[model samples]
Target chain A: MAGTAMTPYAQLVGPVDVYVAPYGTAEPAIDAAVPSTWYKLGPTTGDQTIEHSGDLEVFRDNDHQAPVKVTRPEEDLMVTFTVVDMTYEKYARIINNVGRIATGTSGSANVKRLGFKRGATPTEYALLLRGSADSPYGLYPGQNYIPRCVQSGNPAPARGKATRAELECEFMTLEDDTQSSDDDKMGWGTVQIN
Target chain B: MPMIDPIAAILKLISDNTNVQAIVGDRVAGKHKFAQAGSVNAWKADQSCIVAKDDPGTTPDIDIGDHVGRVELRCYGATPAAARKIYNSLIELIRDLEGRTTANTSNGTALIYSLVMDASPFTTVDPDLSIDMVVGYARYRIHEYALEEYQ
Candidate 1:
């Protein structure tokens, strides 16, 4: 499931995998091994979203109250997914981008800690989402790539009954000037479905 | 359009294995049949061959096509003992493919999400051809698409 061909019967499925790497990292093949530099950021809640947001501006003249021209002067690409588990690296980067991470034994006990600190900027990263789709022909697999982005969600864990805690992570994609291709400036993805 | 031909994908799985190919070579033919010679289907009585027959799998999802399917493989060898050996080697490969991808089949391909020997292979005599045979069943979760649909 690692080709670009698609058909009318194809249907995209959940965010099966998620990872983050450097801003200029190339999107990997569906079968390729996850590089050591990339950090796995999921077990998601299967409610992931990739959204194109912003408003379209409409221009109107007094002479023609109903006639006008509309243009989308601005837009944004955002990705959101609920991570169910708490991991050291994921929490550190999200909570305090400038936080210090340390690991040692408290006497005979093992311990790891994230020293929280205030920071003006979030760390930039290259995010990748590997997803699968179904088709009549065979398995269709591919990945979503955001060349550059920063975590925009500041969700905290909330406890509940009959429900599990989830960290709603969101990202705002930014233009990667280093990328030469137009489609890859913000984000891009394709599934080998159908 | 298919990623690769599905039948070819299955054939590739068997042909790609050095052990299986050493025994059957390009003899991993299609749909319970032997390979054809210049003009007609032919195989020597002592020659080895692996016959494949696909079944219409159970549909796992209606919206996004996926299948839990079966493929019956018949191993015909020079002797009954040899048939068991071929079956053992082939099953080893198939078992290893439980969570692996099939070579993009000619008609289509699939991620073999999970595979298991639904029916274990055993040495037997083919009633119709009187050939030494070992038959088995593979239950597979075809993640993307399957040749079963195309057939």
Candidate 2:
């Protein structure tokens, strides 16, 4: 009998969906139940880094050594995306949470700072990268909280040159201790491979 | 009646080549390792390896009991040049096995009739940069017979 042949399928065919929710709260699914706060990222590019550590042992008689135990130490997801709207309120909110925000009012003669604060208690979000819906092939990072973000760079405007603002955000996956069962600790954030 | 397992004999012959072993190791977890059909997805990016029996064709021969069939050798590589090198190495080894005989415990004996480069090697770049693959196919004919019974 002939061997089973693998059919070609598109693995990266859809736009990515980003969902935001308060920390220690229930996460929303990527389907029709997406929350209003969920925002689709503008064009983005990045990858996830899964770090692992291993212990090796060697014997006096054996010439080769092999790892005895391997463990995953950390997983970091980083992505860079262009800010779609400069005047959007979500931009201000994100900046307020991660950067310093200042507000001041000038009367007839002088102006003074009314309030200023640095972002604290970052919110968690889910990033869903969809493959073909017909097949199980997608990447979902469940309950990823942004640790840090920075503007890419400031470029001077010139003739025939276009400038687009971009932000590079780094995310770390956290275990959902709120879940009642240990099986749901990661909360379905994984690579979908059939 | 005793017969030689053609698949085992072919795999053994390919594994015995030192040059091939140096390029693609004998173990599956090696950087470049030999594989069977439908297992190419497991190979790492830019890895080079050989796959056997991907395509086979059998036909009847009046002179001999049966002309087993044409076995295909698929060579994969990260780059066109790397793939061509592996393909050439396989062709050289197959040519050396011409007119040779090998036996298997399950099967009796088999004679290698000839080796032919059925198709030229060609390169195809995968849109997914992770899986760029180059494939080449070769066909060989073998004659098999059961061991004769002594009265």
Best by TM-score: 1
lDDT of 2 by residue, B30-83 (tens): 133423346854555567776666355555445433344555555566676776
- Candidate 1 lDDT tens digits, B1-151: 4444333456667778888988876678775454445634577667788887775655544544455567788899889988888888888886455224555565554444445577757678888788899988776554455534443
Runs in model 2 lying further than 4 Å from the true structure: A1-4, A29-33, A37-64, A73-82, A96-121, A124-161, A181-184, A190-194, B1-151
Instruction: Provide TM-scores for the models.
Output: 0.53, 0.35
Residue clash pairs of candidate 2: B3-B107, B3-B108, B4-B107, B4-B108
DockQ of each: 0.04, 0.01
Candidate 1 regions exceeding 4 Å error are A1-9, A62-67, A96-99, A105-108, A132-138, A160-163, B1-151
- For all candidates in order, the CA lDDT equals 0.69, 0.44
RMSD of each: 10.0, 20.9
Cα shift from native, residue A116, model 1 (Å): 2.9
Model 2, residue B28: distance off in Å is 51
Worst 10 residues of 2 chain A by lDDT: A1-10
Deviation (Å) of B21 in candidate 2: 59
